[model samples]
Target: MFYMSTASGIIFLLILFRMDLGKYCDSTSRTAKAFANPLRVKDFWVLMTLPRFWAFGLFMTGVCGIYAVYDQQFPVYFSSFYPNPEDGIRAYGYLNSSQVFVEALCMLFAPWLVSRIGAKNGLILTGTIMFVRILGSGVAVDVWVIASCKMLHALEVPILLVSAFKYIAGNFDSRLSSTIYLVGFQAAQSLTAMFLAPVAGYGYDHIGFSSVYVLMAGVVGVCLLISCLTLRSESSRTPCSTVPDHAPSPPATTAVV
Candidate 1:
């Protein structure tokens, strides 16, 4: 089933590519370049010097760790609530479907929300929602209650993930946008998983599922505080052109005898 789904996705992307519908409408490409070179390395170091960059990286790490724990443990937590295992599984399925539906709706309105509130404020909103959702999950008694929290989870994805991308692109030079994003989103999340996965497993073993959620809630709450304190409003952001130029000119080649 997974392979079939993957194949379907590949085919759909191919169709889009064939029709040239994959092009970005904006002149600026938001796509990240995967290959590393001297220029990207220099840009990355320049980005690292900013305090806001560290704040954003830490925020991404904490949120991704919380998500990893919730994704792994929620099934066990859900199954424990019902006497019949199948009933618990069915309930979990319903919650997943509802969350996906909510996420779809959130995506439809995400652009408008970003336009109104801006990326920094959007992160604040989503970070708060994520904190609330994780806290609610820790104490939720009914499946429907958890389902409602899952809807909030959908709203967080666009605000945290999409807005973070926009924040990097808009505030920094276009040359550095992709590198900064890759570091903040992908590398930070990967590092969080590597360290936190074992800790979360130990937590589930010793303290049970609810404790894990509570712990995650606290972590996300801290991240929210950091984001609120460090993230600047859109109006106050430095224009990309005014950002310090860090891209290095290519080294001159020497002709060897």
Candidate 2:
């Protein structure tokens, strides 16, 4: 919820720097006129053909689940920086070591990961890391160690994002694809997230943080296995890697509300 506000604010500021909100609508009209019979949803409904994309999402979700557990332990991490327990909130602001490096990696090499490894194999590798990392984080209760574990978000967010864009752009029509691919997924994710978040948070507070972490990992593992079965078992080797570069990422404007 906080990051949602932050992202919206940043985009609004970016819009102000370039053009007014009215112009944004006008630009959309122009863009619509520019292409005909573009990417459509009917083209690609079955997602498994695109390699372990579902597995990749599972892996990412596992990594994301960690923060839910970690946040519940904030007082502990906060205590380290501020000797005064009440000043934990202030210490949160001063911690800079992990964030700087993580952001740098996301900005610098995310493209290279997609361009170099290709989304298929790259996601599998990352997903594997996701499974391993979650299990490890739960096993170790060290606060600093958990903080260091956050470096995975850099990988988790962008890797899943770029791969999703790559797959949708290649498989769907450009026009309707915007609504179906971008808006549709965002909507579904937003709805599910609202419900899942509370369970994770409540689980952390009551049942135990480690239990929540393991459940999150279990969710991811199930998805990963399903994706593997669907993609790997298909003997039909009709190459689906057809989209080229210059594929604009659904305007990068669609976010689940």
Stretches of model 1 off by over 4 angstroms after superposition: 1-4, 19-40, 241-257
| Model 2 spans with C-alpha error above 4 angstroms | 1-34, 38-97, 231-257
Name the top TM-score candidate: 1
Residue pairs in candidate 1 whose N, alpha carbon or C atoms collide under 3 angstroms: none
TM-score for all models, in order of appearance: 0.81, 0.59
Of candidate 1, the 10-residue stretch with the lowest lDDT total is 29-38
TM-score of 2: 0.59
**Tens digits of lDDT, candidate 1, 110-159:** 87888789988887887788788878989998877776776777787866
Candidate 2, 99: how far from true, in Å? Answer: 1.9
- Model 1: number of clashes? 0
TM-score of 1: 0.81
Q: What is the C-alpha RMSD of each candidate to the true structure, in Å?
A: 7.8, 10.2
